[model samples]
Target chain A: MTNKLLYLSQADVKSVGLTMAEIIEATEKGFMEMGNNRVEMPPKPGIHPGEGGDNFIHAMPAFIPAMDAAGVKWVSGYPGNQQKGLPYINGLLILNDPETGLPLSVMDCSWITAMRTAAASAVSAKYLARPESSTIGILACGVQGHTNLEAMNVLFPLKKVMAYDPSPENAEKLARFGKETLGLEVTIVSDPKDAVTGCDIVVTSGPILKVPHATIQAGWLNEGTFVSCVDFDSFFSREALKEAAKWTTDNLDQYNHYKDKVGFFVDCPGVYAELGELVTGKKKGRENATEKNFAANLGLAMEDMAVAPLIYKKAAEKNIGTWLTL
Target chain B: MTNKLLYLSQADVKSVGLTMAEIIEATEKGFMEMGNNRVEMPPKPGIHPGEGGDNFIHAMPAFIPAMDAAGVKWVSGYPGNQQKGLPYINGLLILNDPETGLPLSVMDCSWITAMRTAAASAVSAKYLARPESSTIGILACGVQGHTNLEAMNVLFPLKKVMAYDPSPENAEKLARFGKETLGLEVTIVSDPKDAVTGCDIVVTSGPILKVPHATIQAGWLNEGTFVSCVDFDSFFSREALKEAAKWTTDNLDQYNHYKDKVGFFVDCPGVYAELGELVTGKKKGRENATEKNFAANLGLAMEDMAVAPLIYKKAAEKNIGTWLTL
Candidate 1:
């Protein structure tokens, strides 16, 4: 029997034209599967290859039987790469044929990581944020800052973006993209507090750190602000996290796994629900307009599994990817 | 910057013409790095996607800084595939540039898995087996049975083979290959005991089980015998395993991780040393002629990381694989 699979490059993946709404829908379906206990997702296993155990290459695998998606994302994060003029994250996603366990496609994971991660935040915000939420605070204005704005724009009628980064150049780049591509009023902020203070939604998008040098203070966040932490407590202080009335994460097992190793969720509020539970209506999301809502959506493998099949199917239909024998 | 990587199919990987000795050397070097605490290899994490949770797709990642190799082997084992006229194992090995943490190449892992696993057994035998060992007993005469004979032939002056399999046809196939390819006297044993008894070297290559139905008993092995178990404890009974003078495995953390989950090493002899310790001269292997040494080399990701860089380098030099933009 011949073993052949499609290869989708970053350009090819982008050419597939998967909208943020579509990715959010797929991501929500994946969370529903997780909520219903129909998905098999192991806590991501990673290896730190760089000095000081800061840079990591993680293997994230998940099987969503409901979507017939089974695969792994081999992704790496090198904080030093920013100085080396390379992307901080780089890797590939391998999608498999669930029946015979053969690879069906190998695609660039950078785009998927950017989109699905933002979509996960959007999904969390869908349940946790008010429908009329307009302003968004974006910390660490890099790839995720741009993608998060695009995704949040798809969900809420956003009017302005408050962006901050250690590098003013990065914040400016995101502001340019926000103004040109997203057509939103973008304000480059000087401080993290300025970003978080009166925003309807806040997204922390910095690099995930083992020991966070947190800067977001407890009272900086406005009441009823929906906070989506993609950076794993890197920007949010323990006191800041405690201000949330409802605390939820994408996956509790994964959060606890990293929490044990990295000491991230220590002395925080007890987790009110997993994002999936809210998706499945098994637990409440935002109860009152005055209550603070926080969701730490650590990017899950099932989110990639959910969106990857769509990319593969559409790419195959469009004949946009290269096919090679295995 | 262009992100391009060579894609080597099974044919391309085979065309590299890597010898069993070369593979063994690479695998041994990987073990030496592990012994010196220079390699980063997390315990392989897997997900069972099939019915009854019997079938598994595992993500094995390792970083061998000494070899400048960092990558992952995304592999799957579906026993049901054999009945459907497909190979029981299939997947890909992704090699990465250690400095930048970007993928360098993608290659078929089936050949690597088969060859590297057998090379691990041969590396174990290099330390544990007597140099004058001639006869080898092989249980489960499938692909591993063929590869194990090839690897052992590279190390020892082997003259005869005793092969056993549940399927008579598989045993016959291996027997024919042994006679035709290696010019060794082949015997098809009717029972597993017949295969193990009186053999200087024994290799058990079967399916790894969560709950093993072991068959090999305590008295079957001979004095001065070297045993390599690639199939976990599926073939060797607890009493049989206890017969070994010293017990060793590829990695203790991995062994204990699986042991906690699958109950494989429970009540067995304590592992005296990892195979790397023996390779690095930190631990003795076969101390005397009458000693029985056993190594349960549950295949390490560093083995693939060590070998894959060689394949990628050679494939690039030979221009043998397709280069795809990522």
Candidate 2:
């Protein structure tokens, strides 16, 4: 008769420190489960029945079918959030009983975003990125950029990391941050190509309302390299994506929705073969680590979907916040 | 920057002891605002294209375009809920500022539900039930049954109350309980006709798994008597509802969803009106004291919509729960 309501605060969540490494790892695990077809990844575009609002509020919920736990997360994006000092991406993740209706926990979703998006990139790298890849190129120094590197390092043994960001402070901040925190060799490059050259993994987390090119110089792309992105605009050419040996997304319906909103990124490697499909083995991962591939890391609901259960468990174990009794 | 999560026990809500009279008055205000088209009731059924369940989760949100707050109450009906002990209807009424996304409160929906459903019913009786209605016939003497009497008594001058239940002891217990607590005439009738005869109103708050019908001898329905139902059964003939001078519901879309689920129990009255629509001169209420009318109280999102605000205001004023630094 009791409702299991667990509350976790930013401080509580921080004290527990859902680490950058942890998010990357969980995301990889998420993809592993998804690829095995044990994770539920429903479509991501939501109700647009209302008028005049540019952002879409999507409902992403995932239950690792084998794990017996599920979480439903609501992610709302309105580009206008910046003018108001709110993070452009904002959401809540509620972990609940998969069997009963009790709400087990509620957590801030900023971290959920980092892990899922990066996990998606990691899945692409595991399957499509070159095995001998020694360097990685990054396009931004924000949160997604931070996690993307962690995911790459875990899934691939990269020797060098380089980035291009207009903000000196961001570049400097992440320069020291990545080295000290992630233990990666880092450098700040002056131009996109300065960072793009000779790299086997090209990762782009963009400030893309303003962007470089969607299509990179084909000559610049080393054979058997991989390109991963959170923004399709960062790599504008569908042709660039088409050239890769393989294409993938966290979920295909989501990729299609994104295509509808932002236009073609590439003929997506058929949407069903998305990360979850790959996990489920409906499709195979990299024929070899040397396969050239492109994965659009559009952040699957399955990421928050899978992570929701983790947050609920941790918060409950700690008796984190005030319980709501009804 | 802060989330005020509050919990109230069912006992605490009962302690609020807001009578059907007070709630009736509050709903009058709610109706005035709703009638002005201030209440935003949007189409709730959105099927997730790739979702695997037979049930759909709907979101019903409203902004009293002129009020201090807004909320999107997510009412997810998976139907799998019934196999578990959970109540079929479950959701959170999130209260937030209209100008800012600051959440003022989060409260249990059960209280909001019990009160608002009763309030809407009371408002219906105020406008549609017979004047000097001395007695009422109650079918399905459960939660809905108990509250309908509480609300009806507040809006009418009832001299007696009678009920028929499949479980005779349950009927006897409820009757004894009502007589002791409600303090007026109450009885457990042996026959459905006995419960209905000589009563000015017949109330049906049914949650029957299948359709239920009550065959009425002509005299069992006194002249100028009214029928109110929370059920979608073939309890009364189509001729009965067709002959009603007025036919109404709290929200039209909700009734339509119900209509789709349970085919018409009555003929479509040539006159169809919303309770709030009538308040705004979009339609009219009862025109004659003797008019036999039917009010189908399917309930609305806007009713529980006020709970978070009400709880926020009350909890803030009374310093009811502990606060957390998140």
TM-scores for all candidates?
0.93, 0.83
lDDT of 2 by residue, A39-143 (tens): 655544332222354554455656665555565555556566678776666555556555544456666676667766787787667666767677888877787
The 10-residue segment with the lowest total lDDT in model 2 chain B? B43-52
Cα distance off (Å), candidate 2, residue A43: 6.4
The global Cα lDDT (0 to 1) of model 2 is: 0.64
DockQ of each candidate relative to the true complex: 0.75, 0.23
Q: What do the candidate models score in CA lDDT, each in turn?
A: 0.90, 0.64
Give lDDT: candidate 2, residue B233: 41
Docking level for model 1: medium
Deviation from native of the Cα of residue A266 in model 1, angstroms: 5.1
Q: What's the CA error at residue A273 for candidate 1, in Å? A: 2.1
